[model samples]
Target chain A: MKAGHRHPADDDQDATTQLAGIATLARQLATAPPSVPDIASRARAWRRRQARKLAPAVVAAAAAAAVAVSAGVIPGSGGDSPAAVTAAPAPAPPMQTVRFLSSMASVAAAQSAPRPDVFWYERVADETGPATESWESTTQTGLLRAADPQQTSAIAPTAAVTYFAYEPLTFAQMRALPLDPAVLAARMRATLRASGRATGEHRTGSDQEMFESVRYMLGWGQATPELRAALYRMLATLPGVRVLGQGTDPHGRRGSVIVVALPLGGVRAMLVDPADGRLLAAGASPDDASPDDASPDDAASQAPAPAATPGGPGPWTPPADWTYRGPIHYNVIFEASGYVNAVGRRPE
Target chain B: MRTAEGFEPWYAAEFPRLVASLRIATGDAGLAEEAAAEACARAYAKWGRVRRMESPSGWVYVVALNEVRSALRRRRLERNHAGRLRAGHAPPPADPDDALWRAVRALPERMRLAVALRYVADLPEAEIATAMGVARGTVAATLHSARRQLARELAVLTIKETP
Candidate 1:
């Protein structure tokens, strides 16, 4: 993201020659049609036909990735494993080998053993800072409620927990997803714009000022539910990656969320409250911890909980040309745009 | 504030040219087109924020050109590090029609954008700097660096052809 190195002064002559060589090669390959109407039509067709075919596979692959996350994507609810945080716990019922297909089945079952309080019903609770207002219960209706409906396990409480495999409705999850890239871009743009200019002197304000970033980012919650549903569907189609058994983080939070493996891993992880559905704050996974450790916030002692978590906060825009693999929610897309260019090799 | 009425004509006129230059610079037509569109989209979305800047087109060029450089860099990285597990194959060797474009791709990401703007897209160094959100001296230095890189690449190719 930052510039590396460049030489000036006497280096000018050499720079020009280099620029010319590269530009010359580029000029020769410019065979695109000179017409605007044609290009637009082609782009439109690609989005409709090619994009449509590509979208579902991406969802499929991502769904597979999601399954991977059951051990890796979201942290294991039972946070004592030594492996990657994103790895999901195997769904081996108490003494039974009941293979789990989703974290909902596993986590739901784990939580099924009833607690005496209401906090257990609410997986995340907001204490303070950033996304506080957004804290609400998943048991309530609408996308605002739970992180994943498909992955949710059915809990039968009789002063004790009972987690029976109740795989959430995938179709219902898909139906409530977002798909249009352009619309997503627009909403993000608007939210970002509002954040920059929303202030009076642009310097500072009350507790409201602290929430500026949240206002711009999470404002999408206010958009039409239809769009939210579309996003839900899109996210569901992303790879299924759940963290394996959870463990204590370097910062020492009694437990840690898992990390998506390399190749498909996203940058940070969200830490939701086990008490309320609200997100507390978000910081980098332990792997992302910086070298300096000088910044108190960057270090574990005072790091804010990540307000955004997978299937909870906004989705990460997939890198271009990379096909969306698992559920859109998994963020495990791959860059398979242009590997092979023409004919192939002959047999030896 | 600038309506399509005010900008469309200029855009339609320059759009094809921009695409051609970006395609070469990025070594991928898709990347070029997307970069150009994303830059313009941002421009169109934030016309008010940029109208008063030194040169509006320059600003757009900076964004689009940078996009080209970034796209090229990303493509190269994916090709090199991703391995055969899932990546597509490397692109075919370049034809002359796209030689300069490939060369553009070969440039370091930032330098490539600066060169594309100063040479291929054909804008002044100052405006290029503004569009790129860098100091004027930075733009000048970047242009110089790109030219040097271009010459070396050309020289290498020329030497190989000698009898």
Candidate 2:
């Protein structure tokens, strides 16, 4: 019967028996002192990281401000959101939300386009302290200055001039982007997907990513007023966007905030100047209420260890401490932004 | 939570097998672990869905192999001969000239993966087919070819040893 088997049963068994030594080798190698990371735990860590990445854009702040904002450790937290002294607890009547977003959009649309020049200059100030003044050129020459003495000095030379790794789009390129919000959304989705950032099994480029892309353009890339208007229009179509009433930015700039609820109990709020439709600040508040067994007090106790802030690709950092109820806001107060002839030279 | 509980045992059982198979296939233990850990992490991230797939282990093997290939490609790009020792080149064999491991590493990439999945991972032909994304018969043939070559190489080594 064994000889009659079509599968070469005895031969296969002989092969398997012959390969037993290989199995022994494998088992021995497996037993060798593990030089690699624990996959199970590493997998869990990656999931946590992806979960944070999938969270909305509110956590996206400028890179320079990140260290200062987690300011409890670094003395003299410049431009950090002042611990709001809760004052007159008045019933802040229902804020007029629609008129707010649309009017902001109108002002944003009407703003004049920046004139063509060699460099784009911007000075951004935070609420409590620290500010970064950056000058960039389409030719890829760049300079950055910050309040920190180390950061503040003679305009230094940098290798690349493109705004935010995705080379800053020329004003013309910004205009050439898909004008239709739906088409624009698709284009942005394709860009995000191509970057491989949108790769978790359940990923589909959501409006949240669009929001970040737009913010990135606004922060690093040149965005014509028309492009800014289109971004707002695109954002208006996305689900889960809501007005959070009027709030003051860390820069003390008053703006109406629109919050987007993120996946797995997180929220991102963008503070837009209702007067000019300028995005003043962005912040994120994670769902402090997750983790079934932990009490709020337990969370607060776990909060201050200053978990590694993500300084990777995106400008965002998830809520490091589970205890915080408020968002960590990145306020951009543009003192001067225009075309400059050189990287070191501020625009006249 | 139920799914989490379900995956834990599955992970524990496969972790060592994956490490050993990848170690043999890539000829670098550290690279093997990194690749396996990365694939396993992706699996965990999508556990809610990955656990439902027909062969999750197969998926992991595929992802790990890709990782190794990419690392090798990157190492080639860097033109760092020293870096090659870290990722792809077989380490100094314990016996200095270990014939078996040298012969296994000498196999073509696909054949090496086939051999590792077959003997080290101890996977059946059907599952090996799933892991390698080939037909079941192809896996069988590949294993046969690998065995023949390995046997020939070992014979030559033995003859040389006898002399």
Best by lDDT: 2
lDDT tens per residue, model 1, A56-168:
33453454355435644344454544233334332211111112112222332233222222112122111111111111222322212122433432211111111001111
Compared to the true structure, candidate 2 yields what TM-score? 0.42
The candidate 2 chain A region of ten consecutive residues with least summed lDDT is A293-302
lDDT by residue (B132-154, candidate 2, tens digit) is 76899999889887776666566
Q: lDDT of all the models against the reference?
A: 0.37, 0.55
Per-prediction DockQ comes to: 0.11, 0.17
* Off by more than 4 A, model 1: A1-348, B42-54, B65-104
**Distance from true position, residue A273, model 1, in Å?**
17
Question: Highest TM-score among the candidates is held by which one?
Answer: 2
| lDDT tens readout by residue for model 2, A220-311 | 44677776776776666554455666777655778776765443355556677777677676555544333221111111122111112332
